[model samples]
Target: MEHSMYPSMTKELAKQRSDATPEIQAAFKAFSAKVFADGALPKKTKQLIAVAVAHVTQCPYCIRGHTELAMREGATEQEIMEAVWVAAEMRAGGAYAHSSLALDTVNQVKSRSGA
Candidate 1:
């Protein structure tokens, strides 16, 4: 089997300037502003949360934005790295927790089906 470092984006089409209508831009800007609100949380906390959420969501744009924000908010390199690790741990835990439910379901199915 062929292995790739990242999920393929080949099927994902890039947008041209003409492809972006004014309404689309406005909507995107509004959504982003709402998600990354102004001063709703402490800058440092917000940056860390943003970084963690970015990692969890697997959003490269969010990760880059928040990594910069974290640095600007006086977070040390070590702190930023630790925050990413924390995100990784939480995401892995969530996956495992959910998988346990699936495992239980499989077990129940096996018992009922006499597999």
Candidate 2:
């Protein structure tokens, strides 16, 4: 039986992109490898951060990829969940931070209308 969209579609598409542009793909892989390497932060911590960022970006592929990498790098379920919570908080905080812009705009309009 052939399914319209299989569960592995994302992985298959990613592989296709890598095959289509091997050089650029290889460079990205290398860059990501270097970025995630253990330095001031450990590999597991970096993975957790990646997972959090993936959540903030709302990228399903990235979230799955980084969550798996995080687990492989020794991140516990609790750690992963905590990272997700942090992502949620940060997303909300972004909206909260932008409220200042809304406030300023409202004040400008009110002042212009002499209200």
Candidate 3:
């Protein structure tokens, strides 16, 4: 396996975490279950959204897990790729939109210098 910044998910580590914070773990599990359950948004749509969000969040584990869940929910490869493309655009768009801050600073400097 390739080396990763994140540690391997050993059972020992899982048990250690759970042993330390059993209540929190249980609450988190319940929250995740409720969030993923079918409601207004179907499970498939949720999984696809998860895949997209995972990319935006840059979580490797979530991306892989959600992509699999999305496929099991009948999301096609094309659909997954398209979702990724949407993520890419949103990521780029955030930077593009935030450029207004830099531009505003430049305008402030120009005004101060009377240029």
Candidate 4:
């Protein structure tokens, strides 16, 4: 089934681009290379972090891309799952934290109105 959210490029076009667009491919290669260049974190850890960011940002393309890269970088399934869970928790916490401002405003308005 075709997803309506993302445009479906023609298979022939995709193949042709895959085969012929050296510059386009090099851009992506440069991006991936730069993402792993610093030794601050191990490659697997960085890839897992990328996967977690993808999950939190809700980018299907990035999630799929990073998941594969993480696995290729030797991230265990457990590590990948943990990263996803961490992202979920952080997203949930962020939403909950923001709700407090609304609650505080409501409380202040109610106190001012004596209701």
- Model 1 spans with C-alpha error above 4 angstroms: 1-19, 34-40
Runs of candidate 3 exceeding 4 Å displacement: 1-3
lDDT of each: 0.80, 0.94, 0.94, 0.89
Rank the models by TM-score, top first: 3, 2, 4, 1
Q: Global lDDT for candidate 2? A: 0.94
- Residue 45 displacement in candidate 2 (angstroms): 0.4
lDDT of 4 by residue, 22-61 (tens): 7888898898898776588888889899999999999887
Whole-model lDDT, model 1: 0.80
Per-model TM-score, in order, reads: 0.66, 0.87, 0.90, 0.75
Better of 2 and 4 by lDDT: 2
TM-score of candidate 1 to 2 decimals: 0.66
Pairs clashing within candidate 2 = none
Which model is ahead, 3 or 4, in terms of lDDT? 3
Give the clashing pairs for model 4: none
* Model 2 Cα lDDT, one tens digit per residue, 16-112: 9999999999999999999999999999999999999999988887899999999999999999999999999999999999999999999999999
**Candidate 3, residues 22-54: lDDT per residue as tens digits?**
999999989988998899999988998999999
Which of the predicted structures, 2 or 3, would earn the higher TM-score when compared with the native?
3
